[model samples]
Target: MKKLAFIGLGNMGMPMARNLVQAGYYVYGLNRSKGKEKTFQELGGQAAESLSYIAENADVIMTCLPQPADVEQMLTGEEGLLQMNIKAPLIIDFSTVSPSLHTAIETKATEKGARYLDAPISGGTAGAEAGTLAIMCGGKKEVFEEAKPLFDVLGANITHAGPAGSGTKVKLINQYMVGMHTAAVGEALHLADQSGIDQSLVYSVLSNSFAQSKIFDRHYNDFISEDKDEPGFALELLLKDLGLAGEMAKESNASLKAGDLVRDLFENADTNGYGKKDMSVLYQYVKQQED
Candidate 1:
């Protein structure tokens, strides 16, 4: 059995870890929240209080943290994974973080005989639940192939994009499109109301048009199916990803007028306390404009 240590047992991480355990890996999960750990244990995963224990014992260490700061704390903080005598060569990061930070961690991990991969994911909570995420990875070709089965268990479309940090670069492009489409959805809904068209009719018509997109489908899928709204991917996280897109554009000496414009729009909403809402509430941003 290949022992695995999975960190971050949040909405997305929990199911991902469960899949690995279901696939017959000896899975150990690390979570700061005791409740999360308890749930993981309930799902047949072992819980460890320390990253050291996970790093020391597991054959692979996978992280699904929220931010670059969290990733840094787990890798270099007290009782960090790097503090262990790592017999495992694979350390896969599933967070959407700065490419530079990913590069820095990869450099440091390589020095300690550990291979690192920046492998941010898409597919939202539904994808996590259905095990059909699109994973974009940046790492050496050999390491990526070696880890293919593990990613295959978690995602449907796994692309080994290129060398270190490139996965995150691809992630930024992905977010930029999402932001634009979300903003468009907001505007289209607002316009439909203004023109007195039935909301469902407009959506149905657009759903068949050339402008139709996965993002459009994403807006209606889960929340539409449930008739109630919950945060699968929160607005704050999308706002953060948009900000990263702005930064990425600047670093590449590329102009991101549209991305920056969308970031500013999301920032405005977040500033007004809508940060924790579903990103589809971009409709509210349009509402604010009408008011």
Candidate 2:
């Protein structure tokens, strides 16, 4: 088993790291927060003293960060992965960053005798906890193959999207659909409420109808129905992904009519104090618009 360093231990990374530890891989968990590191430690994973410690010790480094800038600083900053004394370590980034940034990091990693893969993931916090995420990877075929065992422990639907930056491309596409579907679910539920239709009846009908989706199932059942406001996947985070999607569209000169519209809705929600709430709170945001 290769020594693995799992960084960013946030909503998705913590569970994924725990899954790796449970699978008998010796994982060095690195997080900026001491509380999160303690949580990871309680899961039978060792907590690293610093980024340099993992960079020096681990054969593979996996990061699930919040933004592209953070990923850049972690990989190329003064006290970053590039500065560490390591021999050919593989860096797998699970953060949803831009293709251009992905390419830049890949180049830097290659120059330092390390491999980098843009392997952004989907399926949300539930999927991360269950280890059934859809991981879209972009890198050299050989490196991808070498990383398969680790990916297997973290994801269920892992695919090699193409060369460097392709995974971020596919992930942006995935996020585009996710944004639209989330907005659609909210709108449909709002319409149903306005029509005096029972929420349960609407859900039952939609579950058998062509309008049904995983987003509907998860949002309605796990959140909207139970009134759970916790952050399974925060609205602010979704907004970030939507912003990345918009960036991807602009770079490729692609039209994102619906993407633009739904992004505004999410932006509104984020600005209106629902940012920290679960994405299912979109339904509440929509409902409040009428009140």
Candidate 3:
């Protein structure tokens, strides 16, 4: 088994690293924030002090950062993995960054005699915790095959999405639908509230109807109905992915009419200070507009 370095112990990363530990990998966990290190330690994982530690120690380094810049730093910064003379042969990035950045990082990894995969994921925190995420990977077929055992520990649906940037390309498509669906769910629920339909009844009927989705089930039952705004996936993160989608669309000369509108809706919610809240809070933003 390749010794693993799991970087970024946030909402998604922590659970993912824990799952790897549970599967009996000698996984070293690292994070920018020191607080999360103890949580990983409790789960039978080793916590590294810094990226340099992982670079010098592990054979496979995986990152689940939040932004493109962070991913860039991991690959290109002064103390980045590429700069280290470590023998880690594989790097997997699960961050939902741009295809161009994925390609750039893959090239850099190649120069350092390492294989890189842009393997953005889905299924949210629940999926991460459950070890059933959907991982779409872009890299060499042989490298993906080598990584399959590790990916199997984290995801239910593991697909090789062609060349270096295809995983992020597929992920942007997923996020595009996710944005529109969340917006649709918000608007539909707001309309139901306005029409004096019992919110419970609306959810109950939709749960059995063709209009139902994972968004409705999660938003209505878990967070919105309970009036909880604790972030599962934050509104700002969705906004960031949508912004990336907009950039991808422009680059491909594709028109994103619905995507643009949904982006603006999330932007409005973020601007109004709901950015840190769960994306289900988009319902509250939609409802407040009519007040």
Decreasing TM-score order of the candidates: 3, 2, 1
| Residue 188 error, candidate 2, Å | 0.7
On residues 1-291, what C-alpha lDDT tens digit does candidate 3 reach at each position? 678999999999999999999999999988888778888999999979677777877899999999899998888788788998868578999999999998888888898889999999999999999999999999999999989999999999999999988999999999999999899988998998889898899888988999999988888888988999999999999899999999999999999998888899999999999999999899999989888
Candidate 2 per-residue C-alpha lDDT over 14-35 given as tens digits, one digit per residue, 9 for 90 to 100: 9999999999999999988889
* Candidate 3 residue pairs in clash (backbone atoms < 3 Å): none
**Model 3 compared with the native: what TM-score?**
0.98
Residue lDDT tens for model 1, 1-291 = 788899999889999999988888888888879899899899999988577677777778999998778998888666667766777558999999999988888888888899899999999887887889999999889989989999999999999999889999999899989999988887887888899997788778988998788877777565533443467888899998988888898899999777777888888888887778888877776777888
TM-score of 2: 0.98
Model 2: ten consecutive residues of lowest lDDT: 79-88
Off by over 4 Å in 3: none
In model 1, the Cα lDDT at residue 127 comes to 84
**Which should have the higher TM-score, number 1 or number 2?**
2
How close is each model in CA RMSD to the real structure? 1.5, 1.0, 1.0
| Error in Å for residue 282 of model 2 | 1.2
TM-scores, each model vs. reference? 0.96, 0.98, 0.98
Clashes of 2: 0
- Runs of candidate 2 with Cα error greater than 4 angstroms are none
The better candidate by lDDT, 1 or 3, is 3
- Candidate 1 residue runs with Cα over 4 Å from true position: 224-227
